[model samples]
Structure formats: structure tokens, C-alpha cells
Target: MVRRRHTGRRLRSDESGFTLAELLVAMMIISGVLLGLMAVQTSALVTTAQTRQRAQGTAVANQVMEQMRALPWASLSKGMHASFASAAGGDPNVTSSQLHPVADPSITEPLVTSTDQTTDRAPLSGAGGSNKTVEADPSIPGFTYTSRAYVTRSAQTAANVLTLTVITSWRANQTTTQKHVILRSQAFAPTGGCGDASNQPYLGACQALLSGDAGATGPTVTVAAAGAGPTGPVTTPTTPIIPGTEATVATLSVGTAGVGLTSQQATAVEATATHGGLQTLTADAAVAAVATGGGRLTNSASNDAGSAGAAPANPADVTGVGSASPLTVSGTGMSLQLVPASGTSANLRATTTVSCATGVPAGQACAASDLTGGGASSVVLTTGGTPFTVASVAGGGSAKTLGARFTSAAGTTAVGCAALSGPGCLGTSVKRTVGLTSVGQGPWTGGAAPSGLASVTSYTDATLVERGLSQRTTAGVTTRTGTVSYWNGSGYSTLTIDRLTSTTLVTPAVTTTVGGVTVSASATVTVTPAMSIASHPDPVGCSGQGCSVTSDTGTLTLTVTYVVTSGGIPSAFTAAASVGSGRASAAFKAAPSA
Candidate 1:
């Protein structure tokens, strides 16, 4: 194709594609929109990260709550706790300061996380940094959660009711600011159980509670209702109603009076004398009667004076609050006196007239009477495991038979018996006395017998006897020699047996103190010198031919006496033994004629 020449011309604004200034303005607008979109996307990503961390915090809080629930009642102490050390430093066993309180309005809430990387001087980029947790978000490298717990007991229910609060916190994107979640729960521990010290009064009390029903009704109430009327009732008989005759009255009577107003002195005096020409008499009249009846008496009279059944002019105004009336009685010469019982003390005395079986001269005192009909009404027991001691004699001079009580030694450990108590319940202590242990001798050995007599042989015989206490030992030895004889067809055959015995006593005697009482044990033993033949000729006599000798044996007796003394009382025991009880007999048998 051929080229053609064209001339240049100006175009309209609508026809022009673009200008440098317009292009710049348009580029700036497009860049602005793109940057705004990018900013929104970045914000969305951060929000998603924060939400994920919040979710993790919630899970961590729940996990801490579960841990608190797993702890037994005995291990849980009151106050805040954390897996790591707390910011508000204190005894970690009590309260922790690891997760510190939040900022500003929510400062009361302890929401600070352990891995708040910004709080420290250096960046908490590594897992080894302080306040870092192993439970870090694997996807979000440096993010971690911190968990804490608090425990408290109810005022009304005490340790039986426990409340637990768990908190979990974490830093948002490794910043100083933290987010957290809280959870609260409660735990219960049964009261009056075997572990409680108050529930145990003795071995029996704790044991009984182990098998007792905590919800059981009162003992007097026959049936247990949904809502009982009282916690503990003395007596509320539903069946077999109590009769009025058998029922007890609130107030007791003194003699014939409905009230306890009669004085002891007034009653005793009235029984012994007459007053004012009337058969009934008062205390003053009784004193006068005693004076007239050849018995000297001194009177102490005030309110009633010498009048019988007379009321005082100004009687005690007991009706008014905190009012009192004073009556004074003073005298020196008196034949008899009576005293009332008081706090921490008691006294009683009486004397009876004596009529001698045989006549006695005047002005001479009668023979002293023998006391009788008196014995211990009750016994007081002390705490178990106290060692027994002689202390002092309970019965005074005249007592022939005395009583004593014993208990286990001190530091004695208590044990449990399935037969007496339920599982985990302790039983009473087991006590045993140390006593005589053994009496024995050493073994016998064979040896040569005495020679000189034809066909005579001897063997050593040994005997032993010994006695000892629990903490002692003993030894002994004895010996005897004897001859055994047997008859053949032609003559008598004899075997001389000898015994040499020896024994050593380890402990001849021993003494020890038990409960302030001296105890001693000793042993004495002796052996009989004479030996007796225990068995004789078994084949009878030799029959018309040769006779052969056989083994023979003799026996001796050993007597032993053991003595033990305790608290000046001595006890004796005896024992005996026979030596060479089982052995061959000294006998000859006749051979068959050839």
C-alpha cells in the first residue's frame, strides 16, 4: 500500500482517552479504595485471632474448674491459687498473685495472663520467658493461657460446704492487655465422719459413727418423718403410752410437804421432843428436851425464839428482786452438830448408844464396835495406757482384801479389730503381762560306764531344771548312776550305768519395777542321787544253754521349785522330770540248745 500525507488537528474533550492530571487523580482514587479494603481485611484477621484466644481462655477456665473438683476435701485450702506464682505474692499454699488484677474499671477482676509479653522489659517471644505456659496456642506461636482458682468455706456450714471459683486469662496477640473467663462451683464434705476429731469421744465413739446413719431420726421418735419436729428429743412415746403413775414429776417432795421448804434441823428436832404442851414440837423445844433428859445442850435460836410454830415479825421478803434477810445463831457448848453439803465437799457423822452384852462398870467407855456393811460403790477409771502403780492403799488399815486396776503400758499403740469395729475404725488397746517363760536342760551325750563288775556298763545320765522371768534366762545340769540286774539260768547279770550331767543357768535371779511395784523371780532345782531300774528281764530265764547279755537302763528324778515375788507377795511353783525314760532293758535271753 502507498503512504498518504495527513495534517494534525485538536480533538474534543469527550474523544480524548485521558490526561496526565486526570490519570493521576484516578490512580490516587483506585489506590485509596484498595488500601481501605486491605485495612478492613487486616482488621478481620485480628478480630478472628482475638475470638479464638477467647475461646481458648474459656476452655482453660473449665479445665481449672475440673481440677478443683478432683481435689479431695482434705487437700483444698481457702483462698486463691494458681499453677504458677501469683502477682500479689503470698504463701502459694494460701493465695497466689500470678494472674494480676485487670486495669481501670475492671481492676477488681484478676484477668492478667501469665504470658502478657508486653509487661516485662524484654519481648516474651520464647517459651522460656517468665509467666509463660506450656498450653500455648500451637498455631499462634507466642499466645498462652494462665489459669487460677479460689476456694472458700461457707460461714453457716463451715468446712462441710466449700465453694470454688476458677479463672483463666490470656494475652491478646502477645500484648499486655488480657482476656479471661470465670467459673464457680461448690463441693460438699460429710460431717461427723470418722476423720473428724470432735466426733470421737473414745475408741467406741468414732467406731460407732462409721456405721451410723447421719439422717437417722431421734432415738425416742419411733418413725422418721419427711420433716421431723425436733433435731433431738428426750422422750416422745408414740406407742405404749406412758402411764401417769410411772411418769416422773418435774418437782420433787420433801417428806409430807409438796415443796422442799422443811429444814433438816427442824424436822430432826420435832421427831425428838414436844412443844408448847402440844404433841408437835419445834427446834427450840427439842433443844430444851435434850437439856432436861440428862444430856447437855446449847441452843441457837432467833426467828422463832422460844415460841413453837411462831412466824417472825419481819420474814424474808423473797418476793422482791435481790432482797435478803439475815438470821444469826451463836453458841459455844454443844453435844451434837450437823453440817450441810457444799460445792466440792461433803460431811456426815453419827454416834449410836452402846448396850454391852456383858455388864460394865459405870463411868467406863464400852468396847469399840467393828465397822461393817461398807464397800466401794463406784470406781473411777483414768485414761488408757497409763502405767499401773502401787500409789497408795485404797482401803485404810482394817481392809483384808484389796482391789487393783490395770491398763496397757504407756506409748501403747491402738489397733483395729474387725470383730469389734467397722473398716477404718480404731479398736481398744491390747495389754499383756510379762510372766515366767521357760525351764529346760541341755541334751545328754553318751559316755563310758563304771568297770569292775562282769558285763557291767555305764552311760552318763543328765537332768536339768530352770526357771526365768520374761526378761531373764536360766540353765541347769544333773547326773545319777545306778545298776540294772537280770537273772539267767545259771546266775544273775548286772550292768552298772553312770550319768554325768551339766547345765549352766544364764540368769539365776532378776528384779524389775512394774507400776511402782518390785517384782522378782528365782528358780531352784535338785536331782535325786539314787537311780532305779525302770525295766527288767524280758526273756525270763535262759533255757538249758548259753545266755547273752543285752542293754540296760536306770532312771532318776529331778525336782524344781520356782518362786516369784510381786508387791511383797510371793508365789511358788513346782516341776519334776525323769531321766533315761526310754532305753534298752538289762535282760538275758537263752539260746537254743545245740
Candidate 2:
């Protein structure tokens, strides 16, 4: 504990004065301390500024998330940045990314935010507050605050629920890495519609769905395909809901019901009306038109099978009557004659008095023309005088038919959507009563041979035929019956369709199906991801860490929530939502070297 002092003058070794080297060393240490202190002060100031910006960014993110949570499910669509400049709820990108099926895309004032705002929003007042915030920028001294929102189904595990994530970001400093503050929330599409209708998107979507069931004649409502993108919403059956007596075939179930369904999947409709404690059942469908009935020809007992039916034309002695087996007469001048229609004449009568289909009447002089039809074989009457003129009949192919056999199938074919949802599709049954296209032969074409064994050369032969067309063809119908079930989300309903009861018989098109209720080729609804994206300067925006370090290439993931169930058909089904989004970017990076 010895104290030493030094004067301004240089001193001897024993005088206790400091050396030049010691002074130099002390000066060097002090200079180093001062420089270090200055550096520490500068660093602390920079750190404080960076921390403030980050805090502001986090606050902004929480503010946005709180605001989003208050919105309806309809607003939880895939998108990035949207400006609240107009009533349009949609920028081109926001519009294309809408989830719910709606017509007017008026984005309400609250859903959109101003990218040019100067203040950070308080957690309570999301619009804005006194928290000072910097404009989002990637360049130079000051930090920039940028924000964005993303919606996706892939990130969510619940049905009828969507994930909404708000990301607020800023650069720590000119040389520091960018930072981000992310806040996430969820929105659900409730049973009533648009998840309670808090915002315009939710209200519009819910109203649109209800409007789809408008104009129906009954209280039971059928939820059909609606809006743009997809149709034929098989999510719910066409129930007697809304405001009619069509009957409540079924109702929506709890938890989850129709999961994956669309309009194309609605193969049938079932309705039940209770009267006096008894329920009357009705089941049918409306589909596109398919070809139905046709005709075919067939023969009956008159086709000359085993025994001679009723009466057939009997060939007698006539020179011109052509028959496979006929009675022939000799003498070149002899002509053919015919028996009267009444067949009671004992003597020959005038040509007009007696009637025969193939021969001249009795009494009239036989003319040379009467024999003209007799080919190589000639038939002459054994009782007739020689040189008399008569008529002749030519023979041709003969195989008579009864008419159309009425070839038909059990089920019919059809297409199109039923009445409901929106202006989707409609079809006609097209009960085309097609004509008899072709004819088939049976055993009608035949001729009588004498039981006494008289040959064509021996018996008088005259050409006589019952050929031409003896039967008519007609189109016929084939009937079929079966049972079907309808699951309207809540319960099941059974129905029966019978052709016998024309009134209850299915008159709707697209009714024919082999298995269960109709199934859709694709989902009745679809939510497109972010589209039509663009970059806006601070007072503009992008994504991730501030507009400077992030890019709003305008891409997004979609999460659609819907339900489907077995609508009491042979096979129950569901409707599944499709998501099309992941980590996508237009930013360039160096190729990874192996």
C-alpha cells in the first residue's frame, strides 16, 4: 500500500517519476478503453432500435390475427395482401381465392387493411394505435414493417375449419437478417351457413346457399350444386326443407355428415309425406336423357306351326293362282275361276256379283288376262267349261310376323342435375317412343298340301298367297322396381318408385341408376388458391420477413371444409375437399453442390 507521485519533469530512476514507456502504455490502455466504450454505446443503440422494430412487428401480427378471428369462415380464403381502398372484397387475387360460393364479391371495409398505415395496431384495436411503426423496406438505415395473411386447409385437422395465419415482418437493420412475427387463428363453417355470418364474405356465402333452395314448391329444401367452379353439391340431399310439404326426407347429421359429395353424385331423390299417421314414400331422380323404348316383330299361333289355325285360303282349280302346292287343270283354252265369297252359288255368276281375292267372280266371261299371272304351272277348275277367262295370283315369299317383340332393358340411362342449389343443370327424360326399326319372321308363310296326297301337278293349281305383311310392330316398355335410401346428413329416408302409379312414378330425368344414390365425378365445390398476385411498395407489401426480404409471388394453399354422407342409397358416399398449396417461391438460390 505505497503511493507514488510524478511531476511534469523527467526524473531519475530513484526520484519515483514515471518512465516514457509507462506513460505510453497507460495512454494506449486509456485510448483502447475509450474506443471500446464508444463501440459498446453504438452497438447498444443499434440493438435497441432493432428490438423496437421487432416488437412493433409482433404487435402488428397479433393485431391482424385478432381481427381475422372475428371474421366468418367465408373470409378465410387463400390470399396474401389486399388493400382496403374500395368496397370490393376482392382484388383479382383475392377474388379468385374466395372459398364460399357467392356472386357479389364486395370485400367489407374491415377485412382489408391499409398497407400505408403509420402506426402499429393495439391488440384490442386492430385497425391501428399509437405504437409507432416504420414503413416496410428492405433498403438502407431504417427498418421496414411488412405484413401478410395466408389461409390453408392442409395445416388444419378439423372439418369445416380453416387455418388463417397473419405474418408481420421487418428487417433488424441495414446489415442484419430480417425477422418475422407470425400469429395464427382458425375459422369454421357452421351448420347454419358462413360460420355465424360475422363478415360480408360469411353473410354472402350463407345467403347464397339459402337462395339456391329458393323457388322450390315445397318446404323441404334440397341443397344442390351452386356457384362458379363446381356444381351439384352432393353434400346434402334434396330434402323437403325451406318452406314446403315435399316432406323431410332427411336432415343434417351431427359432428360431420356428407363429407365428399357433389351434384353429379345425386343419383336419386327420396321424399316422404306423412298423412293420418301413415307415411307415403316417393323416390326419383333428375338426370340427362338416355335412349329408351324400341320395337321388334314376332309371330303367334297363326304362323302355321303344327295345326291349321282358324281358316286359310284354300286353292282350287285356277290357271293363274300361284301356290307351292296347287290343283292344276289340263287344256290350253281353259281359264281360271273362283268360288264366291258367300260360296253358295251353284252356277257361274257375273264378274262383279261373285268375289274372290285372287280369282275372277263366276258368270263373267273368263278373259285372257286372268291367266297371265299363272307362271309355268296352271290350275284349272274341274267343273268349269273350256276356253273361259279367269284371274291368276302370283306367289312370293311369305313368313308372317305378329309385330314388335318389344326388346327392352331393365334400367335406363340419364344425366344432369336436379332443381336446387343454383343455375347448375337440367335435363329431359326424352321418352322417345321409337318406331319399329326391323322385322323378324316366324312360321306364318305356308301353303296347304292335300291330306289325300294330291300333288301340285295333279290338283288344279291357282296362284294364291297370304303374303305381303300380316302383322304390325309396336314399341314396348320394360318395368323395374327397387328400394333406395336417402341420407340427408341427419337421418335416413326410404322410398319406393313404381311405374304402376303414374303419379308416383318417377317423372324426373336422370332417375336411372344401378346402385346407390348418384355420385359426383368431382367435388361440388372448390376453393382456388392465391391467384393474380402482384408486388406493392411499402406503403405496399409481400410476405415472410418484411417486403424487402420477402416475396408475395402470390401463391397460397387452400383448405376447404364440407361434409358428405350415405344418402340412403345402395352405396353411401362423401365429398372430400382438395387443397393445392405448399411452400412455393420465385426467389433464386444457388444450386446445392454435392
Candidate 3:
């Protein structure tokens, strides 16, 4: 078969092989195909390495962001992880302006700044370690990466929101461009920018607290010491502090005091002892007392003393100290002065009885056992070796009061309210008797009349008069009044005066002819406006323990003039007096003797 195939196929020499140019072209084509494959593989390898590095860089950025997120509002500042290591939250009393790291208090807006990177170390593993730069690492296996994190406060999102950004950079090769991976996140500050109250008084903000529920928490709130008064620092837990039921939030030491708490809802405020300390509460029932009697949180030592001067022989007509004749008076005069022998601040006392609530049964009344006394009576004041007895009342919810009844040194004549009640001293009618002396006497006319008795005179004489001490208990308040008067033959000349209400009295000038003598008199009085205190709940926040009472404020003032014209001559006497103003607060301590 082989011999037969050879005999049939005889070819020319030209067809057996190719030309040299063609051969060269074929070789070139093969070489190009192989090179293309090699190039594609190389490109793929490079791409994979780049993707891995990017993932690592992104992870580093994420780590930095998380670190910043864990920090509190106060600690997450320009510093990195260890720069501001404090765990303290924002101080409520300290505003952002006051607390910023920089001295610029006006910087209210947030600024974007690079975090401190000096203390941070690269987390990547490399033989060159900390000493190598990304560009210096050969083979790119030891490429060093650098990370930077920036924090910015974004008001557009929220006042307390912070935007965190992290950028991780590295170089693929010595001549390659820098590549970076960025990651962003956000964190929120506590509501109201408040932190734990244990730090300091931050009541200015974060005043409201979260309700008391299981697993519930809120920022700490503090009551700071400020102003002139008995003041002490008070800090409370995050939970709501039930006044009286819980521990005291603050204590005012004996000699110190605190200013009013601004803008608080019904909250309990307290003072340990009485002194000149005054704690005024601002806002609706914001300043409340935990003491039993709705008493003020203050203290004082001196009683209401008239403008410094000597008292008349029978001042205020309360003490029957003057002689029988109005012309020549010599005896111990009425002195409205109280000096506590022990020099203690235990002066005023009170007792309260609440009425039936609005929704109580029609026939049922409040019980006597419901009486709540401010304190047991003690020695409050003494004058002329005789201590004045304080008066007590019952069954006045808010108008109940304690007062003193003045009597002569011999205990003969007395001037003052008989008893204290919500309706005022119900059974008492205060009367002042003044014995006046005849001035500029006129000769008796031939018949039944004195000479010059019909003449009239006018004068606006200004003179300092003796302070008259008068106490009137009306509508649960005890007002001390000073009156100007002169001694008459038998008693004070009766004058026309009207008391329209507990707060108003009308006294008009008058001229009268009695027994051939013309006498003209005029009197003036000043009263401070009544304090309109709103009704509030006991123990604050409607704790339902009982109702609370309000304290009272009062002033004393009076002016009087009396003139007599006889025998065409005129003699005038004027009296002007003012007693110091005082306030009566609820008493929770021992009451002085009544």
C-alpha cells in the first residue's frame, strides 16, 4: 500500500516549505498571544492586592471611629483616645462656652479639628515596625499606614450631634500615589447636655428628670451654693428625689444662706436653723419647705424696734404707766422691745387645722386631732421683768397666727388682739386711751364760753413723733401699727375712723369744739400691699401628704397732729412714728410660751 501511494504523489520543491518572511510573521503572532496572557495575569494580581489593602485601611478607619464613639461629650474633644480620659459627663451648670478647652468663651459653634495622633500607634504588622515609612518599605510588604480622624459638630443634623471621619493612607509602591480609605459615623450627646449630678450644681440645665421606672436613668442634678445666705452644696441621684420622704438634697448651715432657685417646678427647699438667711423661691411653688408648718426658710434675732429713740411715758396707750393727770406724766412707758435672754432665734410659733376638702361628705367636718402645731411654746420675749404671753388660735388653715397681748407693768390695762383665728381676733375690740393736756388756755368768758374759742388755725408742722405700738390680727395676719396721739384729761378724744377691710383703714382730719375749746387733729397711716401667695401642694409636686401654708409680710406706720385754739392763740402737737417691718414664717421648732 505504501509503494502504490508514493507512485501517485510526486510534489514540487517550492510547495514543501514556506518563505522566511512568513515564518517570521507566524512566530511573532504566537509570541504576542503569550505576552497578552502574561499581562492579564499580572494586572489581575495587582488588582487583588489593591483590594486587600483597601479593606485593611477601611478596617483601621472603623476602629478609630468606634474609639471616638465610646467617649463622652466632655472627653471626645481634640485629643485622641488618652488625651481626654475623663469619664465625666458635661457639667450642667457649666455651659459649653465656659467649658471649652480654649479660652474663647464665645465659641458656641462646633469646629472640625484633627484628633491628636502623637500617642497612637499603627496597628498593622510589619518587620520595619514603627520606624518605617510607607514609601521606604521595600517590596511593599512592610508598607506603613497613617491614619487621621476628625470630629465635627454638625448643627444641621442636631445641636449635640458629632460627625466622625477617619482616613487611612498608604503607598502601594515607592513611586505610587498615596491611596486612602475614609469612613464616617455619628454620635449624640446626652439630652440637655447634662451629666451625672454628683459632679456639681448643674441645675441651670437638665432640671427635668426621667420618671421612676425600672431600668430608667437620668443625669445627675446639683443644687449649688451662691449668694449671701446659709448655703451648702447638694447633689442628687439620677432618680427623682421625693421630698421629705427622701434624704435632704441640701442643708444650709447655721450662718450661711442660699439664693433662690430659679425656674423650678414644685421642689423641696430646706434650711437647718433660723438665722438672717432668706431663701426665696422663683417660679411656681419652686421654693417649698419640707418642714411641717408652711413656714419660711429664714432666721432673725431682733424684734420690731421703732426708729431708734426714747418712748413716751405711755406709748401706744397699751401700758397704763403715766400719772393720773394728763399734765404731769411719770412712770414706766410702753416699750415694744423684746430681748430674748438666751439670744436664740426661737420667737414665733403657730398651729394649723385644715378644713374638709371640697369633695368631702356634707355632714363630716375636720377633726380636732388634725391640729398641726409648728412647735412647743418657749420663752420668746421679756420686758420690765414681765414676759408677755403669746396668744394661740385654732381651725385656720392659712390664716392661723400667733401674737402677743401687751399689758401694763402691773398687768392692769392691756392692748392687743385677744385671740388669733382665721377670721381675726373675733372677740377683741382694741381701744387706746390717751389723756390730752390743754394747750394755750383761754380765759373764761362772762357766760358759758372761753375767749377766742371760735378762732381757727392751720399748720403743717413736721416733727418726729413717738412710735405707737399696736397689733391687729385680721385675716390670719398680725399687723403692727404705730399711731401718734397725746394724753387727754381722761382718755384719748374719740375720732372718726373706719376700717373697710383687713387691708384698708380710713382716717380723716377733723376739728371739733368741746367744752369751749376748739381742737383740730389729723392722722395718716401707710400699709404695705398684701402678699398674694398662690396655693401649693404639701411636700411639693402634690405629694398628697397634706396642704401647705404661706408665710405673711407686714409693715407699720402712722402720723398724727392735734391743735387747740383758745384766747386767739394756738398750740399744736404733732406725732409721727414708724415701726420696723417684719415677716412671720411657719415655725417647725419649739414654740415660745403662749
- Index of the highest-lDDT prediction: 3
Candidate 1 vs candidate 3, lDDT winner? 3
- Model 2 ranges with Cα > 4 A deviation: 1-15, 77-143, 192-594
Candidate 3 structure quality by residue, lDDT tens digits, 1-594 = 455435566688977888899999999999999999999999998888888777766766677566555433444433232221221122121243222222233324344432333332222111212211122233366676765544556556776566665556777643477776666676554444543343222321222211100000000111211111123123234211211122222111111111111011111111112221112122224445332111223211111133244222111111111011001111121111111111112222111111112211222111110111111111111222332211111111111111211111111112123332221111111111111111112221222112111111110010000001121211223322223222232223322222211332324444545444454444444445323222233222222121212222333233344444444344333333222222222211110110
Compose the digit string of candidate 1's lDDT tens values, residues 1-594. Answer: 999867877788889887899999999999999999999999999999888888888887777676555432323422322322434332222314322333222223232223332222111112222222336777876777765455554444454555666656777888888676767666554554433544222112222111100000000001000111233123332110111111111110000000001111111100000110001112233333111111111111122344576433222211110111111111111010111101111011111122111222221111111111111111111111121110010111110000000011111111111121112111111011111111211110121111100111232332221111110111122233544322221333444444432221212333344343332222222222322232222223222211221111223332222222333444322222222221111111121111
User: If the candidates were sorted by their TM-score against the true structure, best first, what order would they fall in?
Assistant: 1, 3, 2
Q: Write the per-residue lDDT of candidate 2 for residues 380-486, one digit (tens) a residue.
A: 12111212111111121111000100011111122111121221221111010111110100111121111100100110101110100110010112121323222
Worst 10 residues of 1 by lDDT: 212-221
Per-candidate RMSD, Å: 41.4, 38.2, 34.2
Better of 2 and 3 by TM-score: 3
How do the candidates rank by lDDT, highest first?
A: 3, 1, 2
Best by TM-score: 1
Residue-level error in angstroms, candidate 2, position 507: 86
